[model samples]
Target: MTGGPRTEPIDARAVLGRCRDAVAPALRAAVARLDPASREQATYHLGWTELDGRPGAGGGKAVRPALALISAAAAGAPIAAGLPGAVAVELVHNFSLLHDDLMDGDTERRHRRTVWAQWGAAAAILTGDALLALAHEVLLEAGSPDAAEAARLLAATVRELIRGQAEDVAFEQRDDVTVSECLAMAAGKTGSLLATSAAVGSILAGGPAGLTAALHGYGAELGMAFQLVDDLLGIWGDPAVTGKPVLSDLRSRKMSLPVTYAVHHGGAAGRELARWLAAPGPAGEVTDEPQLRRIAALVEDGGGRDWAAAEARRRMALAEKALAGAELPDRPRAELVALGRYLVDREF
Candidate 1:
C-alpha cells in the first residue's frame, strides 16, 4: 500500500539512533546498582562492555525503546516524557533475551557470545533477574505522574511475556502445532511487550484513551509482523547480515511460522518434513548440511515462505492503518508508519 504524502523519506535508522542515545544514560544508571560482578555481566550483555569489562560496540536494534518514544510523541508529549517507559521495556526485552539464550541453547547473539555462554548460565540468569527488577525500579523512580499505572501495566505485560515464552518452549516438543496456536504464542511472547511499550508511553504522557488503544493496536500488529520476519530470516537470511547461522531455526527444530505452515499445508512435502523431524538423533544435533539443505528446500516447495511473507505484509498494513487512525500529528504519524514499514521490510 502507498504511504502518506512525504516531502523527504523518513529515516528509521536515524530515529532509532536518537532513541538509543537518549535512553542509554538512563539504562546504564539503572543497571549500575548491581554489584560490580553482576554489573559487568549486565553491561557486557547490553553491548557496552567486553567480556573482560572493556568497552564494546555490539547491541540489539533498540527497536522497542524507539517505539516507546515515538508512541509518546504521537500522544502529543515530548519524546523525553517516555524515557522511563522506554528504559523499562528495553530492560524487559534484554532480560528475556538473556534467559532465552540459556533456554534455546543459543551460543551467539549480535555476533557476540551470549551471556550464558560467556559467563556460565548462573551468571546469565542472575544478571537477567537483576535487569528485570531494575526495570521496575527505573519506572517507579522516574517520577512520572502516572508512574503507578505504568508500573501496573508493565507488570501485566511481563506476565504475558513469560506465558508466551513458556508456550514457545513447550511447542518444541509437540508435533501438533497449528498456525493459529503459533500466532497466539507470537502475540504473547512478542506482541504483549510491544503493545505495552506503546501503551506505557501514552499512559505516561496522559494521552487520551482512544489514542492509547490505537497505539497498542499498532504495536501488536508490528510485533507479529516483526516475529514473522524473524521466522523467515531464521531459515533464509544471510548469515553475514543476520549474524546467525543459516537455517538456524530448522537446525534447532523450532516450530516457527514458516515451518508450521509447511508441516501442515505442504501435502507430500509436508509429510516428508514430518518424517525427518521425527527422526531420532542426539538432542540439539541438526541434520548434516546436505540433509539440512534438503529440509530448507522442502520448506520452500511447501509454500511456507511465501505464506509467511504475505502474512507479514498483511500485518504491516494493519500496523500502518492503526498508526494512521491515531490522533497524532501528521509528521509523527508518518514517521510511525515509516517505522512499521521498515520493521517488516528489513532483511536482517
Candidate 2:
C-alpha cells in the first residue's frame, strides 16, 4: 500500500475491525452519558446514526483505538484490557474532529454535512466539549490500577493538541512561520495523541515503564510520518480517493511541512511561491483550478514535495527503530512497523 511494507503486512482493515468491534459498545455507553441533545449530535458525528437518527454506517479507520488495543497485546495483556484506553482515544479523536471542522469552516466530511454545518456552530462546540469531557471520564472510571496515571497522560495530550490547534490558527495571520515551528505544532497536534494511544494501553496493562516509553516513541515517530503523507495528499491526491479536492491545503495557504520547506528553503521558485501565497487569495481561498495547479507545481518545483516524501520515510524508519530495544513478540512488533509503512505509502 505505502512505499512498501518493511515487514509482511497485516490486513489493516482486520486489525482496525478487531479494535473497533471491541471498543464500540463501550464507546456507545460512554456517549450515552451525555445530555440527550449532545448525545444525539455525538452519535451522528460518530456515524453510528444518520442525521434523522436511524442506524447508519460505521465510522472512521479507528486507527488510534487499534493502536491502543495492539499496545495492550504487546504488553502481554488481552485486547479487552485496553478498552478504557481505546474508548478514550476514540472519543478524543472525535472531539478534535468536531472542533476542527468548525474552526476550519469545513462544510462536509466523509461525504456528509459537518456538525457545525448541519446543527450550527454552537451545537458543534457543545458536542465537542461533551466528548472531550467524556474521554476523561472513561479513563477515570475504568478502575484499573493505572487509571490515575493514564488519565494524567490523557490530560497532558489534550493540552498539547489544543495548543497545536491554536498555533495553526495563529499561523494563518503570519508569513514568517518557520519549518521548525510548523513541525512543533504538528507534534503537539497529531503526535501527542498517537503517542498517548500507543502508550496508554501499556499503562493500563501495568506493563513496565520501559515498554510504555518505547511504544510512545514508536507512536510519536509514526505520527510524524502519517502527517507528512497527509500533507502530500492534501496537495496531490485524487479527490475520488482522498474525498477532497486536490491542492486543498495549498489553496488554504496551509503552512504544511512541504509548503513551509519550499517557502523558506527553495531558492528562486520558493521566492516566487512566497509571492503567490502573499497575494490576497480569491475570497481567501484560491478556487481556480488552473491557478491551483500552478501553485502545486511551484511547491514541487521549490522542493517541498521531494523533501516531504523523504522526511516521511525517515520518520517511518525512526518509528521502527524506537521499538528495537523492546522485547515484544515478533508478530505485534512487525504489525506496528507495517502500519507505519502503510501510512507512508497509501494514496489516501
Candidate 3:
C-alpha cells in the first residue's frame, strides 16, 4: 500500500492527546477510590504506568473514551455527566489489551514490552481483573439517570467480548475461515464495545429512539472499519510506527482479513496458505522465515491487501453517512465526523 494524501488536515494525535489528559486524572481518581489498598502499594510494576505515577512507556491513542464523549456530545448530552462512562469504557478497553497481549504472547505494545512479557502472565491477568472491577465502580458512581441500563450494557458487553475472544482463538485452530464467519467474529470482537459506548451515551442523554439507533449504527460501522484497517496494517504497515513486524500477521499464521480474502480469491496460492495455517501447532513459532515470507507474497499477489483496504473505506463511508441523519449540534457534528474519519484512516 502506498502512503497517500489524507482526506483532511486533522491531527488525530493532537485530538486524542487532549482527550487523554482530560480523562486520565478522572480515571486515576476513580481507580484509586475503588481500592485504596491497591493504590497504597509501593510498586505494582504495571506495564503502562511507572511507580512514580508518570507514563511508563506509552498508553494508547485512547479512542474508546473519545468515542464515549463524542457520542454523548452528538446526542446533546453533558460532557461532565458522561465523564465516568468515558473513563469506564477506557478502563475496560485497557483491560482487554492487557489480557489480549497475554493471549497473543505479544511482546511489544506501544513500543514497550507488554505487561505479560515484562511482569509475567499472572500479574497481567490480575491487573486486567482489577481494571474490570474498577470500570464497574466508576460507572456506578458516575450515576447517569439510566445508570442501571448502562450497567446492563456494560455486563453484556463484557460477556460478548469474551465470546469474541474465544471465537478468534478458535479460528486460529481451523482452516475454513469463511468471509461471513470472519465478519461475525469482527463484529463481536470490535463492534460490541463501541456499540455499547454509543448506546450508553445516548441512553444517558435521554435521546430519542431514532438518534440512539443511529449512534449504534455509526459505531458498528466504525468498529468494522477500524478492524479491517488494522488487518491491512498487519500485513503492510510501517513497523517503525506500528511497533509490530511488517507482514507479522502472515508470519504468525493469524487469520486476518487479508489471509481470509486470499483464501477466497487467490486459488492455488490461497489453498497453499490455508494448508500452512492448518499445519501450525500455534502461530509465529515456525522455524522457517523464508516460507512465511513466501506466504506473505502469495497474500499480496492475491490482492488481499487491496480488498481489505477497499472494504475498510466502504465501512468508514457508511459510518460517516449514518451521522447525516443523527441529531447533533454543530460542535459535536464537526468533532465526531472528524473522529470517525480518523478512526478509519489513522496510520498508528
**C-alpha positional error of residue 334 in candidate 3 after TM-score superposition, expressed in Å:** 2.2
- Higher-lDDT candidate among 1 and 3? 1
lDDT of 3 by residue, 1-348 (tens): 112222455566676787777777787676676454344221233344664567566466777777777667767777665677788888788778879889988887766666677668877787788888888878877666677777778888888888888999999777888977888888888988887776667766667778777777878888889899888777777888677776677667788988898888878888777777777466346546677678878887777777888888898778767777666666656666677777778662
Instruction: Compute the lDDT of residue 298 as modeled in candidate 2.
Output: 87
TM-score of each: 0.96, 0.96, 0.88
lDDT of 1 by residue, 311-346 (tens): 999998888787666677776677777777888897
- The candidates, ranked best first by lDDT, are 2, 1, 3
- lDDT for each candidate structure: 0.86, 0.87, 0.74
The TM-score between candidate 2 and the true structure equals: 0.96
Best by lDDT: 2
For model 1, what is the error of residue 78's alpha carbon versus the real structure, in angstroms, after optimal superposition?
Answer: 0.9
Candidate 1 lDDT: 0.86
